[model samples]
Target: MSKDSETPEERRERLRQEEWKDNLGGNLNDSLNRGNNGSLVDLVGGLGWKGTGILIIVIVLGFIVYSVFFR
Candidate 1:
């Protein structure tokens, strides 16, 4: 069957498998080692440098916009 015809449950399962496959580098249970000793930086290690940079920029810009316009 085509992906368009997939049920919601089937679609979710397919996406979940794809994400784990891509995220875990071939294995499912292997997780990132954030050796920052359980600090907030550990969150960034999971996301890596690029993702952390983008996230920080987005958050800072969003906060600035919100403070300027919404507050």
Candidate 2:
């Protein structure tokens, strides 16, 4: 039968199947691109201790400024 002639249930099932296939394709693509050794620790490790020290300084300065002005 033609698509236009299909019942509502058949149409809904077809759409659901298509969505499932699309999701599977996306997951496969992401996994293949990620490879091994790609993780949160690797990302944070790139920043290292220098970045962490800079971030801490900024936070402390921000707190001091807020207390002096707003409080």
TM-score for each model: 0.40, 0.38
lDDT of candidates 1 onward, in order: 0.70, 0.72
TM-score of 1: 0.40
Output the number of the TM-score-best candidate. Answer: 1
lDDT of 2 by residue, 1-71 (tens): 88999976577668867876779977576567657547544454556668867877998999999999998
- In terms of lDDT, the best-performing candidate is 2
Model 2 stretches with alpha carbons more than 4 Å out:
1-44
Reference-based TM-score, model 2: 0.38
Clashing pairs in 1: none
Segments in model 1 whose C-alpha atoms lie over 4 Å from true places: 1-39
What's each prediction's clash count? Answer: 0, 0
lDDT per residue, candidate 1, 24-54, as tens digits? 6634233333232454534665686799899
